[model samples]
Target: MTQKNNHTIARSWDEFSEQLLGFIISRIHHKEDAEDILQEVYLKSINNIDKLQEDSNLNAWLYTVTRNAINDYFRNKQKNKETITQDIFTEDTDALNIKDSFCCLEPHINELPGKYKEVILLSEIEGLKHQEIADKLKLSLSAIKSRVVRGREMLKEKFVTCCKYRIDENGKLAGEPDCQRPECNH
Candidate 1:
């Protein structure tokens, strides 16, 4: 019975992936996110295949799962947005100064390892707070804070090593792009 169920699922994926992906892609702006949702829908459908009563209903069931996944994505996105208080949005000169120096940082950011990379992108690039970052990564608040601190330290090291940036009198990053490292792309 399990074998037959697996076979059915394989057939369904082969037949419906393109159609489902099209539906998902239309609803989702990003191609990668839409593909991820489709993969989630596929996993859920296969894992619970026995719960599906009939093969005739497979397409509808897949669509339902895809819809639920899309809803989950938006729900999480909305939750992340809600976590940032209005106060955090206001520009502090110190933060703005640091952000300004950190401009043209795409390559440095991409070089960060694993979830640390994601944390920096979310917290620094996207301006999510510690709690918001924690919510997004499903990590403890302290863990998120630690990762942010650690990630920043690593990034600072990279800047110093790669671009020769140093602290100014005001303690903000100060340097011209050295363009020494090929990856620095300065």
Candidate 2:
């Protein structure tokens, strides 16, 4: 690696190692396994650092790498097991349930104001990356990111107001959709 890349890696390690470790541990639970995943994230980031654009968000990029490393750890662990047990699959099950539950929010999403609806549909429903949405909509990257964030916030408000949904202690969606509006049927 070049001198600049070396410095970048060192700086990233100093800046993000602890935070990334906590992130991994939150997902992985076991200390040793979380440490292993954190090490893998560091190595992967080192190997792919060149691919990261100079203007890209480093913190976001590192978190994304760390998240992927955690996912891989779980996936490989599942692959090596002879049979999957309920305990081993709880997290994935919860994630799947969350995804399935969110499907019911489509009508609420459609009700969002025009601008928020457009970006939310593209990013959340259509699964477009923020940059891709920006490119497609002829908007600046920052604008697209801002719109996505704002749109999610609005959607959360709609969930609370219309569907009476609230995040539970574990941060999962807790409440059932009980639409308060006369026209709604969630």
Candidate 3:
């Protein structure tokens, strides 16, 4: 509506954004996509600020908006797409070398059995607790823990192979382009 009213809403939104983002991201499978959707939520909220009633609960309104946005995203994709491929390697061209490294790692991750891949991503990337991952996946805690350990080991072995490093003889890392991370002291 008015400039002052818009400013108040934007300020209120800023106060709530971080907590809302964390909650929304927890439900979403992809962090990058979650961010994109969150941006859409902001734009929608700003544009519809006039429609919000004086008595409405802002927090509930925001949650409703976020949920609807997520639903719409899934619905639009479902309408267009057939079988979904594992999209482990998305375009991240800002750091070309880092993206290339991820591109190299993605195939190994994708090649793993589905359960293992899910366990690894939930544990490492999302930083979910074992119990949380277990609940989300509807598995026992011990089962989740075991899968995470096994998945990590499998990934390590695959990475070592991709690097072409001699595990026993040569203490040095391999000469493969993927193995040369600037941060790796080894």
Q: Give the residue spans of candidate 1 off by over 4 A.
A: 86-186
Q: Write down the worst ten-residue block by lDDT for model 1.
A: 84-93
- Please provide, for model 3 over 1-186, each residue's C-alpha lDDT reduced to its tens digit, 9 standing for 90 to 100: 789668967887889888777867888777887887888888888888778888888778888888999888776554322111112211321233333445445466677899999987667544568999999999999999999778766765665666443332322222333464444323
lDDT for predicted candidate 1 compared with the true structure: 0.71
Q: Which has the greatest TM-score?
A: 1
Q: Please rank every candidate by lDDT, starting with the best.
A: 1, 2, 3
TM-score of each: 0.51, 0.44, 0.44
Worst 10 residues of 3 by lDDT: 81-90
- Tell me the lDDT of model 2 at 25: 86
Tens-digit lDDT string for candidate 1 (73-154):
7776544433321212223224433343344355676899987889977886556788998887889999998987787667
Pitting candidate 1 against candidate 3, the one with the higher lDDT is 1
Which residue pairs collide in model 3, if any?
Answer: none
What is the lDDT of every predicted structure here?
0.71, 0.70, 0.65
Best by lDDT: 1
Model 1 Cα displacement at 88 (Å)?
A: 2.6
Q: What's the number of clashes in each of the models?
A: 0, 0, 0
User: How do the residues 62-181 of candidate 2 rate in per-residue lDDT, one tens digit apiece?
Assistant: 999998888887776543321211211223334443333344466667888898899977776545788999999999999998987787667666666665667555433444557666
